[model samples]
Target chain A: MIHKSDDPVIRCDGVWKIFGARASEALDAVRSKGLSKEEIRDRYDCVVGVCDASFDVGRGEIFCIMGLSGSGKSTLIRHINRLIEPTAGSIYIEGQDVNALSARELRRTRAEKIGMVFQNMALMPHRTVLENVAFSQEVRGHDVRERTQTALRAIRAVELNGWEDKYPDELSGGMQQRVGLARAIAADPAILLMDEPFSALDPLIRRQLQDKFMSLSAEMKKTTLFITHDLDEAIRIGDRIAIMKDGVLVQIGTPEDIVTNPADDYVADFVAGISKLDLISAGKIMEPIDAYTRRDGPIDFDAWPEAHPNQSLDQLVDLSIATQHPIVVKLDGRPLGVVTKNALLRGIKGDTAPAASAA
Target chain B: MDEDTTFNILDPFSSIDLGIADSAGGIKQWAIANRDLIQPIKAVFNDIVTAIDGALNAVPPLVMLALITLIAWQAAGRRTAILVGLCLFALGLLDPNAWSLAMTTLAIVISAVTACFVIGLPLGILAAKSDGFERLLRPVLDLMQTIPAFVYLVPVVMLVGIGNVSGVIVTIVFALPPLIRLTSLGIRGVNPSVVEAARAFGASPRQILLKVELPLATPTILAGVNQTIMLSLSMVVIASMISVKGLGNEVLRAMGRLDAGKAIVGGLGIVILAVVLDRISQGMGQSGRERGQRHWWQSGPVGLAWRLTRARNETTPPVSAAPRTEVQSN
Candidate 1:
């Protein structure tokens, strides 16, 4: 579900962060001379942490920014809460410019509106699970009993009920991260900034937490800017993914948009290992019904198996195995297109040259 | 001054003097002039030391021993309590004057350490928060540490006058640097990500310091406290040369007379006291750090009471229930 609200929960406009004593000079060079990141680094002895990053996350949208290490994905997310101020441009949260807020107002916004989870979880080592989870609310001077109740509820939501009294060191890595999640949600903030929160876990535990976080976020309807270096994870959990490289956001689109049509060679290579079986929908691969009928004559729609236009390539494959005929892709009981075995194979192979039937 | 006549290039430099002694005299004069302001502060410190000394001496030696042992058992466990009990017993056996002298010395060290903490903690925190403060404080700490305690004794005695209070002032100067340095180190050593996490959650600077940073830095600060206590003990003895009372006086007298046996006894008393305090404080520092540890009540005096009540209630539930019902009816 893509959420498109007029007032985005987070909007980054031409945000730039160059790190070093000469950051402003480097940024100016980038703008005036159109210097590449390396050129700026070499000329000014500065590193561009984020270069002109701009994106809008709608209300309750799970917007994932994916990149390799040193790609500035983490730096970009931190700008939302004003943890790292933009060297240039502006960030707006719910139509209010974040940069324009006073120091007190910024802190209030962080406490009341945004909660973040760290890759290392960063749960206080001295505090018990319950205390760590209750900390955000406690810092806001919430009533102790009320915050405890809210924290316990969040702990339950994360399935860490019995381990509330345990210290962070006593917890396994996965459990500690669950405490991190619990800590973030306990505050009931509108936005959640998750910085590769599950990237450190083993694959099995990572998948489990991803599923848990996805459902919890959905139920709470939290607007999230999730950062990850893993493309598969972005595809699995993101409503829309922004692919970043060398401190620049290269592309922003839905998972299917990215996998089916990568913007450039870097993004294409990045998603090469990611399985597209589920991410590619029937709408992407189907030949239009008119095109199919023009080339192959009218189909006996009654004889073919019917599937929704939203059916994934994997589902279409399943249907193809169950029947000998092409599947008619339908929406609201009207045929939109046809997904023949040849077109399905080409889609699976990521070859989107119009199928012979489209000819 | 002519360098050529001395046949040395540096001869002219040697003729110049820094006049440090004059500077010291100037400070002494200034302090005397400001006696009105300084006197009340000295009197307050004097009263605090005397009060602590009196309170400690009020407790009979055996009772104090038992109390310390009880505390040790709670903080460090049974083994340390037994060891502490024996050490205190040995001090008594070693010197007839041990209890009274030790209490006086203990009172001085306690006051000095309390003063050090009061002064050092904020400075340490400031140093941790600001690099400029750290740079400013670091060199002063070095001078305080490297200056022979004897060298400062002259000025301290002159400025504060000769008394137990002056001795405490001296001990505080000697014992304070470590607490300040270690506290800064502890706070600075707190994981950066954890502090960031706190800030990300909208914690104010004060809240982050108190709730997140200090608690994480406790073990380290306790280690600093342990060092401060040891330093105070040693300085308390040195402070005795200026008419400060305590076991230090005994040691000083024994030394003047060259009485080997008496000197040994006094030294042994101080040694035993040092070992006992060190072990107890170290134990307190290490408490609650073990993996999967239970609540405080599960391990200390409170645990004993809880167990007794539970066992009695289990034996006669009706009797336990009767009291509650009576209270409710009342």
Candidate 2:
């Protein structure tokens, strides 16, 4: 059987999660009202936890679902894992319709192929760090020695070595997150789902863990779906960010695309006060260094400046114009190309930079 | 009096006189028929006398004191244990042979309490799970607990005809209610979150009972067991009336003989035994509470089991090795 390459590790298509009696009639009424937010809320005591939401996460992509509290970001992610069943429409996990699976099969799938990290860590209080990490395997009837080794490897990957004996209560919030991550990855699941896994941590610890998670994802290359209300976090870790508003998917795009050209006024307003420099990437502004550029003491390709990938395009444009020379585009001191004023301006104005072949 | 009235009264010719005479004849006939049934009861009385005699003749006073001291040392913690042991030793000095009878009574009470717990815990769990069952059982348990211990002797004598079996049966009925109530309360009081977490982990109902509910409720259940033991001890004095040989019988014997010192010593021995058992059971409950806060054993054993299972999973490669496909949306 042929499978589509663009297929998501988990897909929820036109899914509806309505919570009320006469839900079907209410849904019909909302549909007749063109499913406007106000009409849906009024017509049916329905919550519309996920309203006709449709999305897919590609293999190895860190797709983020972001929204304010009660906007259905968590609900949408849960639909993929089937933690909460959708009232209408279909969800597919690894090409098998999730709703079609028996309870036992679904449990098996959750244990073997998918792992979830909950917002509160959800570590079993009675279990220690090792037991928590190895729980899924244990449920699947894995023997002690093998699962322990697997758990240990995962713990090491999350940088939680030597804390295996400690209970979840003994660990700090950040350490608990590491344990949660280890537990999720211990089964070597194909798809890892996290629901605001770091939102409970201090900002600094959250950022640190976020970086660690990204690096781990890069290494393991597993498809990941994360839910969070933090936009900064979405930009920092998401390969593709999906913004949700009131149970509806508002927009889905790369962070640069979202920052430069928000799909709607709501999304634009959400990104409004954030510094544009923080949103522009070196790839977006880089241009070829031409003969018109003055050589500044043998342009050191290895010594290019570093900027946050999220820096505003305007800041890059101003910096380029002020520098009066093609700015070198480098990531960790390996030159990719250059950024001239024209190219930086084009990036700022939401116009594509003229193609210049890579060196 | 008229001559006819006096003659009728003397001749038993009236209706009331005939009825009384007939009832007296019936009583005589019933007693003769039940003579065989009454034999075991008579034997029990004889056995109690002989046992008390043997206890008085065979055991030295100091030995009984030493045995009491040892029991106290084992059951209670060191301080209370020591205090109890010393008290029993003093009692033995007053009358050593009575101490053996006292210890035997303590043994019977403890055994009766243990039996009550065995019967009560499962009933408690059932009650906690089913409201209808609990409602049905409530009135019955109320009757069992409220009826005086002495009242049980009459029916027991009619059925089993007076012995240790009858005595234990009464004690079980008297002491069982606390175990049932506390066990039910403990099971019901288990944390909801813990239960939810266990469910999410795919624990079956049986697993949930063993792993989550039972362990968490253990401290409370143990407390019930302690109460049952105390109640069983309370029944010992009443049990002696049924000819069950124990400290109660020795005490009764002393009171009959009007030996005040022997009665006091026997009563003190019973108190010492109760304190020892109470302290030990309480200590066990406290230790359980302390152990509950620590997860070292759970993680160690459960984690080891999980690890071994994972190893088996790896060695036996999955049969359905399809590169798990990702579902796409249009």
Candidate 3:
């Protein structure tokens, strides 16, 4: 919070995580020859965990990495914390080159700047919920009073105040996950790396924890790299989502961008099931207001239903249903385009920009 | 005789030499004379045994019996407690001075187990932490465990001479391997995910060892200690061959005089002791380290028995046993 530079909180350029004996050489080969993942694996006995991943996370944004297993999403995030070293590439956090940090400096950075939550929720069996939450502070050598207070505040944040003294076994899976989250935020670090933190919980609990996390994220505003395989979750939680396939970053865009204008069929198929209710905006589907006004007679601006450029497909549909006339999509309350019924339907059904205009 | 015929089994040129007694005796004399400064070290071993033996003997038999029974009850269960009490009582009835003899054996076992913990724990940690150390220790432990029990006594007797101390030394050597092996296994078996989590939180190596590895490995380490105690008990009778006085002395004398009754009684005493200690230690490991809750009524036996014996108080459940989940099931 103190350093309010416009620089992104986390930046990784050409981050490569190749796992094998000759990982460096394999990366070089991949860079020079553009080796396929299968070819690299077959030729060098190396698994390309992440093939040149590069992205920047805004200071307060939740950038979700969406991928199925073997997609290198988890491996990519670990590089940010130095939990796994990259074979090649540079990572900078707050303008400090992470790859250049010494071991001691890296440790301090992990302790002081970044916090992480994992799917396993590996709360120490011996430690109580409170002590587990206080772990990061303890690592940084915070005294008993300060750490306990910070830990308590975090436990409270996760709504686990009364269960502070309970061991992990005594708690349910969701509760354990809460303790894991509490542990991560106890230090109140600037960045968080959450690796499928709720994947193990039951669906009901998972949704509940997701809601809990969403609210907490808004309140804390910490830069988060959230890894998940579920497309719906990424779309729901991420400000911008990065999709990975076979160790390569296939696409990175806002949820709206990926949903409305997919980079390829792979991304299109991945987002096929996602509802167009929230993502497809009036601005994306609108026709030129000038030509429409010229063709039609003098139209009273206030007579017809109006919508903002950022209005979701659901909102536009509501507006379309309310009035006989076309919807005027506005940017900064100034008319930028018109969204007729046919154009709205086409926008909803088609990926290409409003395939045909409506009279 | 042929020039190379000395290789024959019956040849007298350093072959088929029946000088076992001479060499052993010579070695013993040289050892006692502190030829390699072995006697001074042996004296240190004597002091440890003496202190432990004195502490064990210091308490009265009835008090010790009650203490052991209570610990067994708390750590294991009512069944173990009952069994230990009955066994000790039978031993006391069988031998005129069974209490004293059992006390003497207990002293040696305690000393030996203490030594095992002191030496084996660090070695175990080292072996667990370092792959090279673990590899080095594997063969050494295998040898320590596999060697004949009597073989260790010979070297120990040569250095320390036949007495209470030498018996303890030999028993320690015989019993050391389990703690070492088990402790290393326990530490190494700590969940990798847990370790990784600790690392992610920026825990130093030392902090990780203390906070994560040790606590999770406690139950396994406790199991090792139990095994060490059992091995120590088994070796006590053999230890008495060198005149470490205890129930073992009774058995040894019984065998010499063909007294079956005394031998059976002595053997039974060792068995009962072994079972009692084993159940208690094993039970402790099963329950695991003191964690999570501190109930008002869980202030040891006084509270436990009161709670168990008293009519189930339905009001105000223990703090630790409180409902954990706040999320609605609907």
Candidate 4:
């Protein structure tokens, strides 16, 4: 699920997007000498969208960009597709400069390689579900039979097979979103740019679609740049998460990395509501079994609490409360380490383990 | 040029009978006095009406009926096509001049609205694209729509000298605002997220307009067309003051002779056309026209929509189609 290759599918470097008549000048001033966002806005009458944002999304990676409204997460995602051309800096998809592409080349790249899903799943009301799904193919002049078959497959993938002939207006909000998802994947593009794709849905439906998206991304292995204000969603789906503040990228790391070791107070406040249970694993906080037994006198062979090395802190807490016995951390049924009472308490409290192993 | 003859054709309300002063001129005075400003504008309408009238009348009545039926069928269902066919046929049989006159009126409406769309669509698109342009157009459109149709018609007839051309010019002035207003409003009202999706998916500007913006904006634009047609039809009897022949002219003649029966028949003709065109255009504007369970024999555009509606009327949302009950094993 996590792709850690040297060659990333999408790379953006030092991207700055300023919105004003003198945007370039404003950007230059910001880069040349550090200026506060308020100062730049007051002095130059320019609004910063994305300021010195840089990141790489490895192939098949779900790189979630998370920020609240006006945080420039949306603006940053638009940069990958060159929908908002950068004020400065470069974007390369498989090493071809996206900003440098001609209009035709950009369109071709968008059509063949990128698919985008938006928060507003306003599937074309005039078109049937099948037609909406097959739109990209139709635009590409693909033959009817072949494109429809592809669209049908995509529809079925989203569990919308029986409703292909229904217009978007007739479908429920969640169903309409599924149709949108089907439309995006119908083209089978190499990249997916999802801009808060599930943000509009009810919480129940949102979770359902999020689960569906995770599996679909795993199956399709499409490199996805997912944008969301919901950190829970980012933690659920992203292999790596980038947190933005104002118009700047403040931190980028795995969900575990962010939760356990937040980059700053802003990111800490953002991740504060996030539960530590899913993020902190036994492998991250366990002491070696030999050291544990030597310190604690002896291990009970029969009464010990056993957990897999990857078990979450919440699971360990449950096990700890269920019994007074120390927890045995086993990998493939062989005891690799121990989760003592002290270690269990620290894990639940989200305290960084001493000599923490990079996981 | 005589007041008695002019009085025979003027809207009854347009004439005021003030004793002693003899102020019978009423609203007509404004038009007469503004002749210097009104003539060139009237001349333009005269030319438009002439060109469209000649082009439409050149086709035989049967050919015209067939073409109208074809368009009706495409826009609506077979019911509208058949209805238009019957109306056209009945008009020809009831009065030999009826068909020709109807065609003339039809030509004028067609030219005015087509010209409206041609001119209005670009302006609408521009208005939608630029906020300043839209703000600027709002008041101008409001003025175009708010002016009394008869007041404008008086000026047009007085300046253009009352003919098919002058009648059409008046109709154009009456019917144009909605098309421009709705086209721009429709484009502006398009869902931004949908447009973003199209752009994100690599749709060129032209492709987005054709496939996304235009299709999504269609219902509003079609509504505009319907309003324009209805408004134009409403102008018929009023327009006949210019001596333009049509069902409107028949009504005017009946009014002059004080014949209610002739007026009724002529009014009925306009009503029939109005209903038929309104229903057909509204049907086209409605979505889900072709997205229902259908019989295998469903064929042409009208047939497709017809059968689909018929089939839909007989069915409910399929309960068995609920796939949500499936376990999320994936």
Highest lDDT model number? 1
Candidates 1 and 2 compared by TM-score, better number: 1
Q: Rank the candidates by lDDT, best first.
A: 1, 3, 4, 2
Candidate 3 regions exceeding 4 Å error are A1-4, A102-104, A291-304, A331-334, A350-352, A355-359, B1-36, B77-79, B288-299, B302-330
Worst 10-residue lDDT window, candidate 4 chain A: A350-359
Quality of candidate 1's docking, in CAPRI categories?
A: medium
For model 1 chain A, the run of ten residues with the poorest summed lDDT? A350-359
- Please give, for residues A1-359, the per-residue lDDT of candidate 4 as tens digits: 24446588999999999999999888878888778889889989999998888899999999999999999988888888898999999998887899889999898888789888878885777678999898888877789999999999999999997888777876888999999999989989988989999999999999999999998988999999999999999999999999999988899999999998889999988777788887999888888877666766666656888999888988988889988777888998888788777877777666657345222
What DockQ does each prediction reach against the true complex?
Answer: 0.73, 0.14, 0.67, 0.51
Fnat per predicted structure, each in turn: 0.85, 0.11, 0.76, 0.74
Model 1 chain A TM-score equals: 0.94
Give the per-residue lDDT of model 1 (tens digit) for A124-238: 9888899999988888889988998999999999999878777797789999999999998888998999999999999999999999999998899999999998898998899
Candidate 3 per-residue lDDT, tens place, A251-321, comes to 99998889877889999898777888777888888887877777776688787788988788888888889
User: Best by TM-score, which number?
Assistant: 1
For candidate 1, the lDDT comes to: 0.87
Return the lDDT, model 4, position B45: 65
Model 4 clash pairs? none
Estimate, for each residue in B1-330, the C-alpha lDDT of model 4 and write its tens digit.
Answer: 236634545576445454533354544676677777866876776677777788888999899888877777666666877887887777677666777777777776777677767777788788878889888988888877788877576556665567776766677677878887888889888888778777777788898898988877988998988898888888888788878777898999999999998887787778777776787777667543442423223434655676577668656664532422221221
